[model samples]
Target: MNGIPKGRHSGASKAECRPFLSSTERDVIRLVHEPGFDRWLDQIKATGGCENPVYLAGYTTVQRAETGEILRHYSTENEPGGRMPVRCRNRRERRCAPCSYLHAGDTYQIVRAGLSGGKGVHDSVQHHPRVLVTLTAPGFGPVHRATDSAEVCRPRRNGGLCPHGLPVGCPHRHPADSSAPGRPLCPACYDYVGHVLWHALAGRLWARFCDGLKRCLASMAGIPRSRLGEQLRLSFAKVAEYQKRGAVHFHAVIRADGPDGPNAAPPPWIDTDFLENAVHSSAATGYVQAPFSSATGERKIVWGEQIDVHPIRGEHFTGEIVTPDAVAAYISKYITKSVSDAGGLDQRVHTYEEIAYAPVNPHIRALMATCWRLGALPEFESLRLRPWAHTLGYRGHALTKSRRYSTTYGELRDVRARYASESIGASDTLTDAAWRYVGSGHTPGEEEIARAVSHELRVARESYRERVTDE
Candidate 1:
């Protein structure tokens, strides 16, 4: 039945009457009439369709070639919207909550799989010695800190003060997120070069640390250096986190598997204690020499004095243990974080004007300025500081794992895709398809409806899961 004012449209057809109704009403009617439309709508709601939904133009079909039978048919070009269904980009918090939540879940699963071994790793790895270690940067200068101790903020000896006339120290109990935190106690004394150099050489330092670990293991095992690879192997996954001070710290899950990886076990001689000692020794001694400065004719680099090594003891361990779930969650949480989270810039420095307005700690700003200045010199052109300004002149990987550490991201994605395909009973045969970005995001009205639906779905899911757990 067509609904239109008789005077407005004397003989309007069903298609012609569609234009008169509100877009919302049209969408609602289209959704109601199409078979399986509810399922697609549910998917959209699950994705939390937001303002600026990405529209996809595509086609799909399934046919029996022998009998020329059209078993299934799907084409976006002929759909009501003249395009395939839209999906939320599923970015992290700033982008799309629905997609972000989905991404976080996948990340959690991926990390968990690596730790406990489910996707492809052998289950026996649960018993293998593991550790969750956090390595922090050494003090460049005294910065603000968060503490509950009453002693915080007490006056320094002799009522000492920095050259800048600021108090030499602060004793006030500062909360973790306090603005004062991470500010240098003595800006002049703070080694900006050392801080930047440390970031630049972080990856190399890790490589050196690994090498030292292997050497230490070999010596302890009484095996020839050449045979160390044949005897035992160390595997690890580490994520670098930017501290409030703009310094990078590392959280890593270290495992000792056979040279061949999860399938094989470490030699009996290699114990938790041995691994711990190796890690400590490496952290203490490992260093990466910085490149010499032609202008200054000097070479300088140093490792931080502080290092932490914790044993990843499961239920079998005697002391307090770090659970696999905790490790996975911690690593995954940091994986999505950026330097901006730690009061650093998220984008590269493009112009001098941009540098002035960059929202970063004064110390980080100084470091960036130094990098930019250095980058201008013909001698230091290779550093590419402007492009890496967001990272504070350090261009190392934010997250890195050993080859044999755990299941890979690629493997996890493939498994998930296969499961999704199998759930729908999709054929194994590959089909070539073309898709182009015609547009992105939803209309304001659609976004409002989507947000409401998504919130309700999230609440419902949470309640359901809680009930199941309680039972």
Candidate 2:
């Protein structure tokens, strides 16, 4: 009677007359009728409506260290399904928009603190000389380019053809969103090997460039390289961004702090011009050697010719001068992007068949194939190109900073976590915490509800911000 219609069918059997329900519909009905449905919804709200919330079973107890008095206690024994939900905290927007939003906000704070000064950094540091530096990769071959204006891509006086009989010049204009921007003029002419190899060596090249910069600064100050730290400290926050061509570029906020650190002022001699000159000198000369491989030969890695250095000003709007807020916003805009933004896969491709079936453009597919083929070589094993074929062999975190740059992501998260719950406020406290992963993800109906919750929360935040600005 529960599943079948109330009225009896004249000729049909009981099973044939039973009401039909999809798996997701049945799940939704069961979940709604559960005793802890409301409590479970509250847990979802706490996670900012995470699309892939991780389930955890755990308990925490806080007690006074001296008197052994219990201060606070939390357990998941009474939670829905004996578990709790937590944010996945993925930085890639394509995978988790809510987590990426939080990450981008944290990144903005980190960059802004190093420039305008906040959080743990002293506000006086705003007067320090800081610059936003952009380092690019050298060209491997000619590719179609997008333009903001009505300008032809790679215009040539004479219509020429490559060795493969493909047109060498692109007389057609491409808008910013056109799919043809990143494709090579001739696939055979493009240096796919060099592209992936450069991606593999990008992190090392950045390290070399930073070292060279410090040396250059020391040389300018007429001091020994080892003693340079005694007078001036270089602190930086950098983020990597993938271009339309799938190559990575680095954007860094480099600040010259006093030897004592951010709270102290830099030496009077260290000005914007001094920093700019050092950056140019280091980028022009710094180089790193790739691991020797008989298949690809030894390659020297260096920053490309297109280097941009902009002095960060304290003023918000000065027309020509870049501002701290502007730099922070610019860096935050790209912090959440992954290879998927450039028409590539977000997950690893373990097999050639996976690469073949991946939903990526032809240009990106070729780069992934190149990484896979090169990863088989004995000498290239250290680079681990195969595991990272999805990212075109790029190795390293998308965001990195010096020890003294600013407050860390971990510290920011800790502060948020504490504020979200009741604070113990005890100077001396003993805490015991144990947690374990139970499971992750949601059923189809749960996913639908989570997406709606996420959207509603996002809108509320934007509306609240608008009201505050108006006030």
Candidate 3:
């Protein structure tokens, strides 16, 4: 500070004032003397307290719209670390837990809004038709599984053995935690090729099923198939969940809407009951024929016989209890999930050797091998099995919804950004920014604080939700 008059700083520098700071803030106080620490903190805070931030070297200037005058200017040139950091914004819990937690919350809000009517969707949509449907993959092989506690896995007559020399039946009443479900009863008898192909084409199967459902609804309504497009539209949100048995199952929230969207109601003739029947009938008959393979033979894929449909009742519904809230939560919960169960890598495979060394269980390795094996055949190249071997052959969006089904993730993020800016009273006419990648992550001490902040945010959100529920 100048002797004439103390400026922004304490007359005695922060170094002299540091002893008064609390224990928790000491780590931060250490940086008080550093010119850019405060600005770095501002940027980190802007990321909503990111765990692992991205580093950048940048400068930005905002100008007034009415006049060619600078409104605000920022640069990372003076930072103690010589770089600015931004949030990673990753949604995978494994990569960034804090960001993923935030994503899961956003997903919950999006689904709930779609279900109960919010986020620009019409409130009358509560009266519109909706159903929760679960479609399962057909059994690729009779793997040794304890279907229930009461049923012994593949009970055999006098402990007989199969031609492969493995036991034909398992006598153990496998517990819920037992790994038997994902393993083939006899490896030789297992249809690994079919399993991988099914995973690859699961999305297509659902698409076909949707088309079939529309046609069924049209037939029931006594309209021409071509006219169905003009009369009614189908909207849905679906999530793919992996079963303990290494197969993927789909849970979908299907909504019927007019061609215009959620605001326009479906033709009165099409109710939830008709939708349910169509779902069951279409799932039963719909099929996708995979490329003919001499080894596994031509396979026609269809939904497993086990299909569950629940009527999605809205806030005003009293006729039948539909767990729309629970349905929304279930689907949202899986948006952050990946195929860890199938033993495939979360990232893509680079070479055959990487797949061989993947941390997957023995069963998953076999499935991956099958994927690689089939990916090589000239006929199966269209399926792109080799690159997706880490996914056990499945390739589709983890979460997908029809454009009219609900608001988009992008819109949600934009709203969040606007709210954050408004809270700080930020405005600009013209903004120019120059940025360069520098580095990422944090020192040990900074990481500890970031984790504590992340935990507090989680607890605070939970407490707020509880209070609202009580109200």
The TM-scores, one per candidate, come to 0.82, 0.91, 0.86
Candidate 3 on 353-451: residue-level lDDT in tens? 987888887888888889998999988888899988888888888788888887888899989877755332346377789999987887654565566
Global fold similarity of model 2 (TM-score): 0.91
User: Candidate 1 vs candidate 3: which has greater TM-score?
Assistant: 3
Model 3: which residue pairs collide?
none
For residue 14, model 2's alpha carbon misses the true position, in angstroms, by 20
Over the stretch 228-248, how does candidate 1's per-residue lDDT look in tens digits?
888677788888888888888
lDDT of 2 at 47: 87
- Candidate 1 segments whose C-alpha is farther than 4 A from its true place: 1-43, 46-53, 61-73, 78-80, 84-92, 294-300, 316-320, 422-430, 442-450
Tens-digit lDDT string for candidate 2 (1-471): 122112334244435644765555555555666899879878887888889999999999999999999988999999989999999999999888988999999999999988888889999888888989999999888999997676899998989899999989988989989998988899899999989988999888888999999999999989899998888999999998989999989999999999988998898889988999999999999988888888878788778899998888755433654888889989998989988898888889889999988888999999999999999998889889999999999987878999999999999999998898788775899999999999999987677557767887898899998999899
Question: Candidate 2: which stretches are off by over 4 Å?
Answer: 1-30, 316-321, 425-427
Best by lDDT: 2
Candidate 2 displacement at residue 51 in angstroms: 0.5
Clashes of 1: 16
Model 1 C-alpha lDDT versus the unseen true structure: 0.69
Full ranking by lDDT: 2, 3, 1
RMSD of each: 6.5, 5.2, 6.7
